[model samples]
Target chain A: MKLSILKNELNEAIQNVSRAISSRTTIPILTGIKVDVTFQGVTLTASDTDISIQSFIPIEDDRQTIVQVERPGSVVLPAKFFVEIIKKLPSQHIEIEMQDQFQTLLRAGSAEIQMVGLDPEEYPVLPSIEEEQVFSVNGDLLKTMIKQTVFAISTNETTPILTGVLWNLQDGELKFVATDRHRLASRAAHIEVDTELRFHNIVISGKTMNELSKIIPDQNTMVDIVVADNQVLFKIDHVLFYSRILDGTYPDTSRIIPNQYKTELVLDTKKLTEAIDRAYLLSREEKTNIVRLQTKEDGTIEISSSSTELGRVTEQLEVKQFNGEALRIAFNSKYMLDVLKVIECEHIFLGFTGAMSPIIFKSTENVNSLHLILPYRTTT
Target chain B: MKLSILKNELNEAIQNVSRAISSRTTIPILTGIKVDVTFQGVTLTASDTDISIQSFIPIEDDRQTIVQVERPGSVVLPAKFFVEIIKKLPSQHIEIEMQDQFQTLLRAGSAEIQMVGLDPEEYPVLPSIEEEQVFSVNGDLLKTMIKQTVFAISTNETTPILTGVLWNLQDGELKFVATDRHRLASRAAHIEVDTELRFHNIVISGKTMNELSKIIPDQNTMVDIVVADNQVLFKIDHVLFYSRILDGTYPDTSRIIPNQYKTELVLDTKKLTEAIDRAYLLSREEKTNIVRLQTKEDGTIEISSSSTELGRVTEQLEVKQFNGEALRIAFNSKYMLDVLKVIECEHIFLGFTGAMSPIIFKSTENVNSLHLILPYRTTT
Candidate 1:
């Protein structure tokens, strides 16, 4: 294979595909990025047996002309070294040519690097999926949904199914849910899709979802998600992402959410978030990272935490409204802080069923995002 | 102690002193910052046995009152927690008052933090210097000298004295030297001092020198360096820094540097440095990180490296002048790279004695900075 490409274009494509390459892969060829040249353009592919990423650079761009293909062939070169050399090359254009007996030459400016390449046939092939069950959604919305719920998924490998996020679609609405049995996060959004088409359940590994979130641009561009029996493909502008689906049933989380509450309070989200953050700094030295919340009859909420080894911190904030009876409860400050950060709202309402029950946190402006945290039992 | 100080001022002072406080100290009181309040100002001090830092916030600055002293007393509070709370306080001015025994109250806006304090008597007292052998130097010059030599100091504690940078003064010139027995770096600058006052030898730990470099201001500001029998003090404007001197003799590095060479080459510093850096990246995969350099009779230098596991890289650079006979040498690329980065000149002259001897890198514009790197013996 002999080709010359713009340095900037090649750098961007290499970085996108490098996210899927793992240095510790058991498959030797998996540690390299496969490069293929054709009349259409050049394509780069990388995979780690779980997720595959492929990016294409056209022959011509507005800024410069890239990828002049002299001959068409395929070769796999080391990913880490190739990326570093391309990034540090001091020229606008770079030339990569593969000679006989798997010798790859990369030249840019005064620097030239010769590396050994592996046969492209040794690399694993990416799974293919049909476009029949495909749906389109804005990249920004999908990124937001993943960021909000992916962090709540269980990281432990003992419960393999719980390490994935559950994606459900019906009618014109899509929903995402993640839980670790201690805390849960759920988000829903409306997207344009075929009215007759429906997906009852699809669970994707949290690790794969997190990687997709980074590779997909967080803009208004639309991305087509194609779902098959065992493979999932996400097609963006010039990039294609594929991940394997987890083969297990996700537990039903609908019954775990509290339907009613005896106590409720509404307050500005930013103020409460800052107050909780300050309290967390003080409570980090104590076990459970406990912080207490008390609602008074005079429409004020006081947050306090004290550690015998460190110090004590108490903050007071005014509540907009309160319903039912005034009460005091304690819970993990970190969990509450994470929930508040993802709500993205001006006003938040918190509902409590009792002193020793799970509490619900929801935004007044948007009803799609919800967070639930279990309260800690305090002796006092 | 009782006082009300501006939150910004308090935060800055706490941050400065906290750098000297280490959580792993054997002495419990060393983990706390000593806060002393007087009618004129409030002072905060923290020590980690090796170094001590003190910062003062006066009652008035430019006729503006910043600190209000309610009572004259001293107490020690946990350094880490107090700094965190002061940084996050939601008010312009913070009120701090000691109440009862071992309890300190901190108030700012609607946030209140009560922390446990230790008795001030338990804290280690800073050593007092006579200030008889004191000399002043420009803060910028001192900072520059520290940065150039401190990075070469030995990090291993096998030879305790090698971990310190040697500071020597003679004939109105101050010189700094650091070496790990493998490579050495020396820097010097002219300074005005009393004719009768002299400091022949002093060794300060590399870690302490690094800490002082961060707080010293740039420009023509003067800093007084006072040498006591067992401790050294730096009085920079209002802040005071004290460090315990190392208790051993530093090796004489003058004999290791070659005064004459069999071959010499003059080249642009920037081009030479970049070529060496690129060679270093390729040599990193080898066992010794060795790169070979050859000066030819045609006024050209070649840099190359090859690893058994990795491939090979060769780069050619033009030399402005070459004297003596053609020569070839090998050395650790990392050591040479570190020394090259500290050079402050556009052009550098390299002098080599032989294949197994040390190579000296000196700047053509400045005679104060010198780097000596020992060559590695190559089998091929």
Candidate 2:
């Protein structure tokens, strides 16, 4: 396509769209970025069959011009090389023109680069996400919700559906849940929505969610989510991120979470996280990843891990509050650390029904999210 | 051994010596660090057979108490885990006690870590350099010298000597030279030295030079370099870094560095570097890494590279001065970019003997360091 654009603006847009370009794509044209020039703006799109990303730079804004249209046309340039060239181009203003045989000439300052571009018709089209089931949420809040739950998704391809985070919407609350069987994480946020704009059983791959979170701004901007039959689209400002949903139904996890607790403890989040991390180092050597926690009569908890070759580590911390029968439990130290990391509160509440039951952790100051990790039953 | 030291101080000492611990070493004891505590201070040492690094923290330094020596003993602990644990310790004051049977207890705040330690008797001893061939040089200058010349060392192990940087000390001048046969870099500095301290060919591996460069302080403190038969020791304050010297005669590189030039061009180092770098992107794709530079009838030169499939890039940069004969030369743009990155001067002088001869680059402000890159032969 023929267009004159600011190198900085185009570079940033190219970087955003490049997140969808996979290095191991089987299709030839899929390795390229589809560039289209129109009277309004220039759009750059990249897709890997599973996901698609498009970033548009408008011709003019309030302050200055980002791109100027020369002739409206379309072409697909190699994403791998085009991204590198745009970043290292020597000047502020860049001139891109399409010539005969789809030869694209890129000129900036005193340098001129010519590359053979592929026909735009060969590139895959972005899926049309035209479902009326759409909702708007804060960009930062969406990022946080995805971060808190996406890491818990199972990466095993045998259970394809479990590799995705389940999305459920009811009333005005939107929730995300991910479980790898042993551990589960859930986060919820409130967003304004129409009565008919409710979606359930929608599962998006954890990888796609991670990419979307990266592009979402941390500022208080709004992001619109639209769900189609098999594809979902996340719109953030001038960028569109689209991903295919998993096919199978997600398992019902509500019954696994207990409403009552036999033992409860409230402790500083950072302190407990550090103690678990230190214990994890030893457990990681043992290959069991198991750490023992025992409550004493003196209102202190002892955390210990041992390896046959590396000895043991025992840590004692007087938590803020510990009640119920003196409890002794062994759990995966890595899962506990992961739960503690997503929590931003100073204090966290942990509850256990018994040694073999699922342990739950929730931020002491917030009730919208909770994590459950099943304890490891040791022979001792 | 029993002692209480600040976490920060112990962490720094562990980090400095851990560099010598190799991940792929075959010796079991070599993977651990030897910690020796005496009335004087605590010494941390790590060795990978070829290189040994020891960092000592005195019992008390000036205003701060660095180490409290409760008992004198030594034990070898796993360097990999100790470094990470010291960095993540929970308290400022760390108490380490070695009990019977070499059981090491590390306590910080409310956390206690116990680890099995290997007997220090099995650890390799550091080589003692007895040669009076010792010379002192500025630590900052030594770091720069290593940085400028080490990049050109041959990474190919076939040529054992070329993989090391040749150190030449003569007539109060210290020179570091490295070449991979395709290119050569030489850096020299004047240092006060005894007449008997002249050494012709003492070559140290580029990998060891890189580690030494990282440990050298940025300040202008003196670094005592002691040279022995097959070992070299660099002493900076209380840290001792020792490396085994290569056992081969270095090839003579003087004949390759041309003493005469047919074409001389002076240009802004940064501008030419950027232009050549842009041309490099295309040349890299071609795999030949060939970029052509032709002096115009005017004072400007053209830099261009083309690939059969990916097209070409052409850049023109004006030179401050162009004299001697008109010339068109092709060279590896990546080599030229490497030379440009190491030069500190704004403007650089480039001299070419012929179309296929070596091209020399030197900072216009300094003549003590220079780079030579052999040109590629092109049909055109």
Which prediction has the highest DockQ against the true structure?
A: 2
lDDT of 2 by residue, B209-311 (tens): 9999989877788999989999999999889999999998999999888898999999998899888988898889888889999988877999999887777
Candidate 2 colliding pairs: none
TM-score of 2: 0.98
DockQ of each: 0.69, 0.78
Q: Candidate 1 chain B — worst ten consecutive residues by lDDT sum?
A: B306-315
Tens-digit lDDT string for candidate 2 (A72-93): 9999988888989889998999
- lDDT by residue for model 1 over A1-380, one digit each (tens)? 89899888899899999989887898889889999999789999999988899999898877767889998899998887777777777678788889876778877776677777889998888886778898998999999899889888998998988899999988888999998888899999988998777786699999999888888875688889999998889998889999888888899999989888899989899889888888998888775789999986567889999998777889899988788877899999999998998888899989999999899999898899888988999888
Model 1 residue A211 lDDT? 87
Q: How many residue pairs clash in each candidate at the backbone level?
A: 0, 0
TM-score of each: 0.97, 0.98
